[model samples]
Target: MKKWLKYSLISLVILLLIGTSWFTYTFFIKEYETADENVDNIVDTDFEVELPDTLEGDLLDKNESTDKNVNQSKNESTKNQNSQGNNKETSTRNKEQRDTENDNSKSTNSKTQTKDNNKETKNQTSNKNELTKENDNDDQTVNNSPDESTNSEEESEKTQQDHVTAEDIKNRYRPTFQALQDQALAKLNNLVAYAYSEYKKKKENGEKVSYGYFYKKYKSAAKELEAKTDATFERLYTSLQQDLVENGYSKDEASDVKAYYNQKKDERESRMLSKVLDKF
Candidate 1:
């Protein structure tokens, strides 16, 4: 029995040892497997963490590129705006310059036209002055005609030694010429008196002499007076001629003197006639 008991105890010990070894091996192996699995899981977790950082870096780079593109767009837009503004300023300046030039051209044209107008006015004024001078010359010519005629007659008389001067005629035969002139004047006065009386009588009789009556009577009276005046002057001229011959004057000189006396007498008669017509 003691031997069986010892064997049984040894068997129990062996079984226990086997069980312990199995348990130890199982525990160690299982622990080693778990450590390997943990290592794998840690590697996977590290890979996941690094993947997120790479994605973040890529996003930051893309953001920087976008910023650069935005900045470039802003610069391009500013340059375009500046160019537009410069072009507009240039256009405005050109317009102003053109306007100023046009104004200057217009002013020049106006000044030139004014100068031309002034020249025309001056020419017209000069023409008028010339015309006035011509008119003045004509008037002078007309006024000098009588003096020229008298001068020519005096020159002819100067050629003769026996030509009677005005002083000589006044001292020598003035009384005779005066007596004859008075006689003629007295006759003309008497005719004027008769015409006045007739005009007064007709007016008082209420026969306001019509134009025909007045004209006919004046014409007849003028004719009678002219005939009487001519006859008286002829007698006086004949007497003067005879006296000039007695005074040692040539016939031609005597005739010329008589002609001068007759011309002066005729001028006096014309003045008297003008006065009479004015009264009528």
Candidate 2:
């Protein structure tokens, strides 16, 4: 039994060793070699996965779209920032412009006020000058007032004296002028009566003497007498005017008296002419 046991043990040991050797060779060496060959095939051959044509285009498009979205987002953010900056700049510029306009307005107002003040000052000065001139004129008028009054009184007295003298001269000469006027009127009446008597005698004698013819003859003789009377009166008036001038009466006053007497003569002659017509 001992000897059999020893032989059996030896056999078991040998089997176990063989099994171990087989396992090492199959698992370690063969598997390792196979995995190494697979790695080499993956490197050498085209072993990368290949996508379909449509899937590849879609993927590329998707990637491009994503990149575009990212760029657009970045651009939008930048634009927003730029717009904000522009708004800030615009606000600042507007504020500055308002300040500048305010300053200019204030300056213009100040200048206008200064000009108005200067003009007002000039007006005041002109008014003062005008007042001074008016005062000077008033003073000059005051100084000359007495002399002017004296001259006016002297002239008035002279005019009164001359009027009194003219009245005296006219009174002194009136009687002589009346005599001449009465004498001339008497002559005119005599001539008118004579003419009427002659016309009546001719008609009574049936001598065919028209009253008009007798009236014409009477007018001719009366005209001659009137001419002589006028000549005499003219000479007498000339002498009277000369005497009046010598006696301090003006020639104009003497002429007025002559005109009065001549009007009286005309009245007397017209009355005489009316009486002669009535007789006819």
Global lDDT of each model?
0.54, 0.61
> What is the lDDT for 191 in model 1?
50
Check candidate 2 and list the clashing pairs.
none
Local lDDT at 267 for model 2: 96
Screening candidate 1 with a backbone cut-off below 3 angstroms (N, C-alpha, C), the clashing residue pairs are none
Write the residue-wise lDDT of candidate 1 on 1-280 in tens digits.
9999999999999999998887665543323212223222322221111101222344356556555655565565556556655655665576567557655665778666776656655765676577556556655655565455456445543434244443453344445555555555555555555556666778899986544444444445555555655665566556555544655654454565466557856865686577567656
Best candidate (score: lDDT): 2
Query: What tens digits encode model 2's per-residue C-alpha lDDT throughout 71-168?
Result: 56556555655665565566557656755765566577876677665665576567657755655665565556545545654555455445445566
Give the TM-score of each candidate: 0.34, 0.40
CA lDDT, candidate 2, residue 264: 89
- lDDT agreement of model 2 with the native: 0.61
Candidate 2 stretches greater than 4 Å from native: 1-164
Write down the TM-score for model 1: 0.34
